[model samples]
Target: MRIFVCIKQVPDTETKIKLMPDGSGIDEGGVKWIMNPYDEFAVEEALKLKQTAGDATVTVISVGPKKRVADALRTAMAMGADDGIVIDCENSLDSFTTAKALAAAIKKEPACDFVFSGKLAIDDNAGSVSQYLAEFLEIPHVTVVSGFEASSGKYVVTREVEGGTKEIFELTGPAVVAANKGLNTPRYASLPGIMKAKKKPLSELNLSDLGLSSSDAKVSFTNFELPPEKPPVKFIDGDPAAQAKELVRLLKDEAKVL
Candidate 1:
C-alpha cells in the first residue's frame, strides 16, 4: 500500500502569538513552532497502517518554507514515516491555496492508494484541505474519524459526531481521511531515529518544479482580527443552592444564554 499523509507546521500550541502590525498576518518574532497537533494523529494512524501492511510505504508531505518544515518532517520520520516531500512554496496564501499546491505535488508522485491528513491545523482551524483534495482528485473523503480498520480490501472508519454519537463509513481505495486525537498516541522520535532520518530521502520542489503557480488557485483572507478580550470574572459567594440560582441568573442576564 502507498499512503501519502499531509503534515503542517504551526505555532506551538502554548505560545502566545501576536498579530503583525499590518493586521493581515501574525507577528513571527518570538512565536515558537511545532508540528500541527492534529497531524500527529494522522502520522500515528499512517504508521499503524504501515505496521499492518508490512510492505507499505508511508510518505509524509508538507508545503512550507524548507527550513521551517524540516522540523515537522523530522517529527513524522521519528514516528516511522519512510520518506518526506517538502513542497517549496512561498506559502503566502491561506489553507485552500496551500491545498491546491499540495494537490499539484501529489499529482507528480505515483498515484497513491490512500491520502490522509489531520482533521485541521490548530492555527487556522480551517478543516477544508483534505475534503478539497478529495474533490480535486475525485475520490472518497471522510473527516473527524476517531477509529479505523482496513481489511478484506476495504476501509472501515468511525466518524465522530455530536452528542457522543459516531457514524461508521466503509470505503475502498483512493480515499482521503481526517484523523482525530483519540485514534492513536504519537510516538516521540528517538535519538537513533533522528539520526536515521538525516539519511532518509527528503524531496524539495518549488512551484515551477511542480508546474504550478499561485494563479491556479483562488482564495484570500480579507483581513485578520482577534476576538475581544473578556471582561473581568466575577465570583458569587454563597451556599451551593444559592450559587446555582445566581449562576443561572447570571448566564441568562449577562451571557444571554439560558
Candidate 2:
C-alpha cells in the first residue's frame, strides 16, 4: 500500500501577527513557521495506517515558497514518512489553484492507494483543499475523519459532523481523507529521526512543472485587517432586583439586543 499525505507550513499559532504595510499579507520578518497543527494529525494517522498495513509506504507533499516548505517536508520525513515533495509557489494560491497543482503532482508521481490531509489549514482555514483535490483527481473524498478502518480493499471511516454526531462512510482505494483533531496524537520528531530526515530524498517542483499558471487563481486577496479589539466588560451594581433592571436596561439601550 502507498499513502500520500498533504501538509502545510503555517505561522505558529501563538505568533504575534502583523500585516504588511500595503495589507497584501502577513509580515514575515518576525514570524515563526511550523507545520499546520491539523496536518500533524494527518501525518500521524498516515504513519499509524502504514504500520497497520505492515508493508505500506508513506510520502509527504506540500506547496509553498522556497525554504519554508522544504522545512515542513523535513518535519514530515522525520515523523517516518518515506519521502517528500515540495511545490514552489511563491505567490499566494487560492484553494482551487492549490488543489489543481497538487492533483497534477499526484498524477505525475507513482500511484497511491490513499491521499490524506488535515481538515483545514489554520492560516487560511478555507477547509476545502481535500474536497477540491478529490474532485480534480475524480476520487472519493471524506472530511473530518476521526476514525478509519481498512479491510477487504475498502476503508470504513467515521466522520465528525455538526451537533456532535458521526457519519460513517465506506470507500474503496484511491480516496482522499481529511483527518480531524481527535484522530490521533501526533508523534514528536526525535533526535535520531531528525538526523535521519536530513538524508531522506526530497524533490522540489515549480508551478510550470505542473503546467499551472498564477492566473488560475480564482480568488485573490487584496487587503488584510486584524479583528477589532473587544470592548471592556461592564458591571451593573445594585440590589438583586435593581441589578436585574439595570442589566435589562443596558441590554436594551446600549447593546440593543433585547
Q: Pick the candidate with the highest TM-score.
A: 2
* Candidate 2: tens digits of C-alpha lDDT, residues 1-258: 889999988899999999999998889898899999999999998998898888998999998896888899999999899999888988548889999989999999878789999999998899999999999999999999899888767889999899999899988778999999998899999999999999999988889999998788998777799899998889789999999999999999989997
Clashes of each: 0, 0
Evaluated against the true structure, the overall lDDT of model 2 is 0.90
Model 1 over residues 122-159: C-alpha lDDT tens digits? 87788889998888877889999899898855999899
Each prediction's TM-score against the native? 0.92, 0.93
Best model per lDDT: 2
lDDT of each: 0.85, 0.90
**Least accurate 10 contiguous residues by lDDT in model 2:** 85-94
**Which residue runs does candidate 2 get wrong by more than 4 Å?**
236-249
Compared with the true structure, model 2 gives a TM-score of 0.93
